[model samples]
Target: MRITGYRALNTVQEWGRAVGDANGVYADGLTEVPMVLVTTDEGITGVGMGPHVELDAVFAAIDGEDPRGVTALYDRMLRQMFKAGHAGTVFGTIGAFDTALWDIKAKAAGEPLWRLLGGRDRVVPAYASGLDIDLDDEDLIRTYQQYAEHGLRTAKLKGGLDVERDRHRLSLVRDVLTEAGGGARPGLMLDANECWSRKQAVRHVAELERTLDLIWVEEPVRRWDAEGLAAVGRGVRAAVASGENLSGLEQFRPLLAAGALDIVQTASVWGITHFLRVAALAHGHDLPVSPIGTNPVGLLHAAASVPNHLASELQVLQPPVGVALDLRIEDGAFVLGDSPGLGVVLDEELIGACELQPATSSFDGPGVRPERAGHRLLAAAG
Candidate 1:
């Protein structure tokens, strides 16, 4: 079916607790979830979740193209924005349209996305990520306990500001998971969100390694610092995981060539095609790839087809407002149902009814890096 037009909407994810990393936290614990609904000439529609920036420009490339030709159209969309560059939010816009096209393609095939993508298994392994750097000790325990009840034995905590606090918090999460798993060795991970310098990353992770056995340390240094990432990987026992902030495969070449990352990562918001491409690239390097997102159901389908998928980050147990997924987290894995195309259904009524709240502060939010993040070492020295 040929593509017709698209509609954009916004919904909010009520995290129930403050969510943030080394960058900053939304004290109110609310974050916006952007969505797009692409319609076709045959009355078939597909929904995609991501940012809305450059939507009109990007969608123009596929306005009348066949949605089933998703891969070819994905490339065409990139070329459509060649002069303007397809990085940052523009890439996210492309990703949103790409996912929508994939959704339409799968639905048209009358098969679930996993089967359409040639995934043999319906279950994908998962790890809990609470974005809990700002959470107190009691809240932290409560948060992980909820995930453990769902049989999640692995968890990643947000930290990197203070070594002592990170150590304490990591221990707490480990104990929670261990208890839930009947004394099984629980897997623990840390995400510094690129707040530390190379030396600080090495030192901080080294200290934590003395006690906690981290499965991986994520974004210890900046997203693009290949040398710094390699240094951190060399000094720490846990594998270094990054690349969620990176936009495209070209951005990952440097890190891969430098042997910097042990575990490669991509955000779900980047869309399904990008994850498949990144997974293939990481597989060539003999490295495991993981996906990071609040609800990475789409990427999880793509992950099922990749042989090198390590584990996917399960940020929240529930989806955002107005969104529903045909998947269940069971026995430490995501059990995807046989719903055709992404298995995501959006309630237009609920979404339209939800009020959109503006940012509380420019300095405090998910992507806003803290002012003193990389300068913590100098501050300590002084």
Candidate 2:
């Protein structure tokens, strides 16, 4: 089916400072969210979440391309992106549109998106992420304890602003996990969110390791500095995991080939096709793959289909309204519905109740916050 039309929605929600740990200050008292729904000639449609920045440009490029021609279209997008100087925003569009394309293809085929992607397992492990350093000790303990009670065996915390504070709170995470686990500790990971210099990352990781063994340290130094990332990996006792912020395969290739990353963290922002491609790259290296955000539904499918794949990250706090997620958590893992395509839809009722006016200007999110994001941690503070 030829791609036909697209619709975009920008949503804003207020979870209050108590519940927000987004990277930038939502001084407008709202969080910005966006989604794109792509429709095909056959009337099949799929929804992908990301900013609607370049939907028109992407549509113009892919209008007549067969949605089923996945490989060719992907290559086309890559070439266009490279020509555009690999502009960061356009990559999000590429990822988002790729998702809608897969959704249309799978719906047309009458199979669930996961099965279309060749995934046998419908259930995928998940880790709680989106914690902010702004949260206090009690919030830290409570968050881990909540995860433990959910039967989740692992959770990653946000850190990297202050070495001593990170250690203190992480120690509390250990205590809560151990106590919640009946004296056994649940697995732990941390995202410094690329807040430190390479030297600071090395020293901080070493200090944290002295008191608590981490499953891995994520983006402790720089998100794009492969060499610096490699150095931090070499210095730390914990495994170094990154790539959630990277766009296309080019960014992943250098660090991955150099053994800078111990785990591959892909978000749905790269779409499922690219996700699988990157997974293959990591798999060749015998490293594990994981998802780093509340990714689109297609990503969970890719993770379950592969052997080295591990848990997906879900924010402890999603917008209290607007979005509808068909995925559920059972025993702390994500359970996908056997519905065709992604099985996610916009909740008009909730959206009406919760939606704020979309920001008129650009702002950063927890994912790209020049600062580490909030509310999940802010909620804990309350």
Candidate 3:
């Protein structure tokens, strides 16, 4: 099929808070960007995230490219944006197109996205993410307990803010685990969201050594700090987990070569097409892939087929208000159905209702309000 139309819908959604991490508080319960690409003639449409500016740019890049040549079109669009830097802000744009292209391919094949990659597995393991870091320790523990009750065996907690307070919180989680009464304690992991310094990460890892049995400690330092990540990897007893912020496969080269991380979390940075390349490299190194994103999509499908995949990250929130698609979670895993094309159909009405208007802030980073017309990361600008 040929090209058709590209639309970027910027709408508000209740983004949950991530507490006790580099970002002091994390919540953008407002207009979030969603971009959708529609191909007519064949009447196939794909939906993904746009993060505002990047979505518009993606539309401009491949507005008329042949939908069948998704791989070629993806490369052409991505290569054109190279000089603009390859991480952070660029991913929002890249990820949008990636998901859309996958949608097109699946529609063409007349198969579910999961089966295109590999047949659906019984269930995909998940970790609880999007925990509001601002919650009190009691609240956090209670929340985790509730997840444990729901058959979730692995979960991620936020960290990298205050060393002392983080330690206390970790201890509380462990206490709850003991009280919950299981054969082995539920798997506990941490994501600092690029908040800590190398020194702080080292100290935190030393404290958690063999205590809580963390699957990994994610993004202990800033995203680009290869040396710091490597140092933490070498110094820590727990595995070093990262790679949610990198754009393409090339950016992960240094981290892998330097042996900076134990688990590599690759997302649909420009969608599953590039994510496969990153997963292949991580597999070659015998490292596990932990792709972060909620629900059943092509990205989740990629993780399910890859042998090296450890688990998938699921947001600890109900589906967006008015969303109709339901990807069920049972015993800490997702159940994918036999539906065609990513197994998700956007609730057009819901999408329209939440259409983004104007927001005081942008997705630049935590707490960084939009200034002028451009987005700014809180950590970098401050």
Candidate 4:
């Protein structure tokens, strides 16, 4: 079926506020999550949600294209991206189209998304994340304890601000795992949100290794610093994890070629088409890949299907506020069923009730405020 039309859902939702990571604070009890809904000629629709941006060009790229010809459509779009003129909106559009196309494709095949991707019925391992770094000691411990209680084997905490505080919190994360007792204490991860300097990352990692065991150190230096990131990896025993902010192979190539990352995390760069390419690239380098997103609608199936996937990163908070489906977690994983498409059954009422937003996530990052704007990142502007 050809894509008939597309609409963006840029609305203020409580889901954004209560849940967020180390990059920024999202709650004054308010925040906006941008989502896009695409409909096919047959009336089938799919939803893609992430950082919102202008996507007129993206819509133009997909209009009338065969929904099942997603990868072919992706090549055309990628080739035209330069003329289309920029990053945030481009990735946003691709993400939306990818989800919608995959949804339609799986539905047409009458199979669950995971199955369509060659997965037999099984749980996608999940890592507890999507936590607000602003939490205090008591609440932080309590929150992590909750994740362990939910059967999560791995959990991540936002870092790169205060080394002492980060160290203390990580120790507490280990404690929380210990307290939940049954088997081994849970695996722990840390994402710095591209906030630390390479030297700082090395120093902190050295200290942290002395105490808690981390599965990896995410975005430890500026995301664009391929060499610096590799240096940090060389200096530390802990593996370096990145790629949430990366665009695609052009970016992943240098990072991997330089021996920069030990683990690769991807989201909606060039949709699943490009993500698969990157995953294949990472696999060639013997790197494990995982998906990172505040909401994982477009990521779950693909993340679960990757052979070297450690676990799919699910925001520790999004479920409570709710998503398109009743995503259930069991034995530290997100389970998918026989439902066709992405298996996301939208809460139409929730989608309808959301207040229209003026603006949402920008290129720099999500949760960036008006006051925080007016700056470029790393070496240049995207």
Best by lDDT: 1
- In the range 1-382, model 2's lDDT, one tens digit per residue, is 7777788866664533333331433344455556778877877777776667666766777777778776677667766666675446677778787887777777788877888888888999887664545556766666666667777767677776556777777777777767776787677788877767787778878988898889999887667788888999899889999988787778888998677899888877767778888888888889899876544467887787888887788664443356666677777788888778777767766766663663424444444455332212221121
lDDT of 1 by residue, 1-382 (tens): 7999999988888888888877777888788888889999988899888888889999999999999999999999899987778988789889889988888998998888999999999999999999998888999999999999999999999888778888899999999998898899999999988889899899989999998899899999999999999999999999999999898899999999999999999998999999999999999999999999987888998999999999999988888988999999999899999989989999889888988563554235767876777777542310
**lDDT scores in order:** 0.89, 0.72, 0.67, 0.70
lDDT of 1: 0.89
lDDT of 4 by residue, 187-241 (tens): 8788877656677778777888887788899888877789999999998888899
Name the weakest run of 10 consecutive residues (lDDT summed) in model 1.
373-382
Instruction: State which candidate, 1 or 4, has the greater TM-score.
Output: 1
Regions more than 4 Å wrong, model 2: 13-30, 317-320, 349-354, 357-362, 365-382
Arranged by lDDT, best first: 1, 2, 4, 3
Instruction: Give one digit per residue, the lDDT tens place, for model 3 in 196-223.
Output: 5687677766776645577789888776
| Model 3 bad stretches (over 4 Å) | 15-20, 27-33, 54-57, 120-122, 177-181, 294-296, 354-360, 364-382
In TM-score terms, candidate 3 sits at 0.86
Poorest 10 consecutive residues of model 2 by lDDT?
373-382
TM-score of each: 0.97, 0.88, 0.86, 0.88
Question: How far in Å is the alpha carbon of 237 misplaced in model 2?
Answer: 0.6
